[model samples]
Target: MKEVRLPTIPEIVIILGAFLALVFSFTLFLDLPIQLALFISWFFVIILGVRLGHSYQDLQKSIMDGITNGLEAVLILVSVGALIGTWIAGGVVPTLIYYGLEFIHPSIFLLATLIICSIMSIATGTSWGTVGTAGIAMIAIGEGLGMPLPLVAGAVLSGAYFGDKLSPLSDSTVLASSLSKVDILRHVRAMMVLSIPAFVITAILFTLTGFVYGGRNIDTEKVEFFKTSLQQYFDIGILMLIPAVIVVVLLALKKPSMPVIVIGALLGAIWASVFQGIDFADAINIAYKGFAIDTGVAFMDGILNRGGIVGMLDTLVVIIFGLGFGGLLEKLGVLKVIIATFEKKLTSAGNVTLSTLIVAFLGNVLGCAMYVSLILTPKIMEDSYDRLRLDRRILSRNTEVGGTLTSGMVPWSDNGIYMAGILGISTFSYLPFMWLSFVALGLALIYGYTGKFIWYVDENSPSDETEYKGEKVANDY
Candidate 1:
């Protein structure tokens, strides 16, 4: 293995500057696709590696290694594609939308959307699943209700990420906890100190927004027509929901996400045949090509006409290229060098904790993988926390809050791209309203500045005791 060293600040600025400029041009002047933009970004990182004395072959391997980091997510995109196809084909999606319009009042729909998605996401411990299934339906309902797509997308994302950040079942949460050596419960509790207020504030904002927008004023004749079309096209019944219910059970049992979602797709396909009377061959075909819904209603057609194995192709391309860029950055030690510079200034618990957020969030944005942030932030902050006498739980909490929340904000991130594609909103359009990210970031900065809950080194250190105003503190972890 080649030895990697800390990069100078100028090097960091050059690399980041080039990547950002390219991305901005793609979005602003060129109007190229995200995948293409990311592909170009990967080339920039590869060039950086080559400039740093790495071989072309080594950079090539670094790209592949970065791509490897997202293989699991790639598989998930495939399964979710199939799941969407089969679920809608089996009337599972229609059932949710149908019942939703009936029971979920339009005026309160935004608030309702946030609350239900939060509960479902937390229960399943998988944001993608919650978003893919329930989120798809929520967006459809938003369209049916005439609400702004970005607002609805923001509400849904905030709620979905809430569970993804705090739930022990969430991979990000587990990775952050395990990496920092904090018990899962302690990690969750420490996070709740900030997350609770965030959630409450978010819910209130959504509620207030909901009251102002009151979807009841919009004509629902089209949405009602959609439900009517669903009834006439196939057998819409309770049995169609079994697939979603089974997924809930499997998730509660701690089953792996890939198989659980695949099972849901399989069961949905089966239901399409047995109950909905779809031809067996056709049901299987839907899983591959997605359900083609062409109702005269444009909004309904848009909602139902999604999800198949092939549907994920565009997203897979973006993820591959994005990960390649992130991977190259990691292999070249760009991010580590930046973290090293930050570490040089850590003088107190507040400074260390606060700096950890900056490093972790930057890792999420620049690294393009939440896992990378969860891994790299802790590795870089380990010494600083010990020196400041902060508990590992604080590190764990900061890691997840920053890592999980920021991924969905960046337009090219794996999560961000997937969500924008699914919700049919631009990543930037919905980012502002993702209240969880805002609240979490705000609260982290507050904790960082105020020094509340900040622990100190032990006063009994024979040699180092005099360096810090150390005191006996209660164990938080």
Candidate 2:
């Protein structure tokens, strides 16, 4: 076995800079596809790995490792694609949109969208699922209500991630807790210190923003057009929501997402067959190729014509290529070298927490895999936290604040691309309205600097109580 060579800071910078430049040049200025940019980046990283004295086979293994790590996410994306297609065909989504337009007042539409998505995400413990299902319907409803699509997308994303961050059933939450060696409940409690305040602020903002559309009289013509177009095609009723309810209930029971989503897709197909009058074969085909509509209403067609396994192909390519690039960086020790530079700056509690956040943010941006950031940042910073006599729960919370919260804002990230694709809004367009994440970042820094929620660990006493600043504090973990 050839010994792997570790990259120096300067070498890592060159590699990262080149990759970023290529990505920006291709996707931004050149109007080229992101997948092609990522593919080229992957090749560039492999070459750099070889230059660092690693064998081609070793680089290949690293790329495969990165790709394998994200296969579950890829599968979820595929399932979501199928679910969207079938749900649209089954009349579930159209029904939701129709009802949303009828009952949800334009003044409170954005706020309603936020709350509805938050509840759905909390129940299912999957933000992607929430976005793919309820988020789609909300987007259409926003359009019919004459609301800005980007604003609605932002509200939905904020609510989805807020629920996802707090829910114990969430994969990112579980992973962060487990990686930090903190009990899940303890981790959740720790997270609330930052999450709650941010969520409250976000809700308030959404509520205020809702009035901008609410004050204006809703375009009854647009609403009637969408409703009439939808009713003309298929049966839109409350019962169509059965498949969605079942999926939510099953997922809430802690069933694995993959099989549950598949079942949801199947149920949608069944609903389409029995309720919407679509043939079983055609429904399945819709799941594979997506639903098609020629309602003569261009806006309606744009909203309804989406989904299918095929729709996920571009996203899959980006993920695969991004992961491969990230994997090569990981295996070549590039990330470790870069992160070590940040570690040296953790001289105090505030700095420690802040540095952890920075590392996690960098991981999300550079690694492209959300899970990688959640895992790697904490793993690398664990010893630092221990050395600082800080509780691991703090470490976990900051890691999530930096990773999961920020993942959807980065254009090339797994969460970012998935969300942009599903919600039909550009990441940049909705990014400013991702209020929870932005607020949480500021709150975390304040908490760290003010020592408000920073808990200290005493190795001398393993008990759940410690004396700090002349007061006995409960360890809480």
Best by TM-score: 2
The lDDT, on a scale of 0 to 1, for candidate 2 is 0.84
lDDT of 2 by residue, 208-229 (tens): 9898667475688878988888
Model 2 weakest lDDT span, ten residues long: 463-472
Please, what are the lDDT tens digits per residue for candidate 1 over residues 1-477? 555454578987987987778777886788887677767777777766776778889889988887786577788778888888999888898888888877788778988898888888877787877788889888988877878889999889988988776677777787788777666766788888888889999989999998888765556796787678878876777777888899888887889878888998998899899888889899989989989966777767777788898888877786677667766777777766776776767886667667787878787677655656666777777767776666666777778777788888877667877788788788999988898788888787778779765444454533122221233324543
lDDT of each: 0.78, 0.84
Report the lDDT of model 2 for residue 238: 89
Per-residue lDDT, model 2, residue 147, is: 83
Q: What's the lDDT for residue 136 in model 2?
A: 90
The number of clashing residue pairs in model 1 is 0
Q: Per-prediction TM-score, please?
A: 0.90, 0.93
Cα distance off (Å), candidate 1, residue 155: 1.2
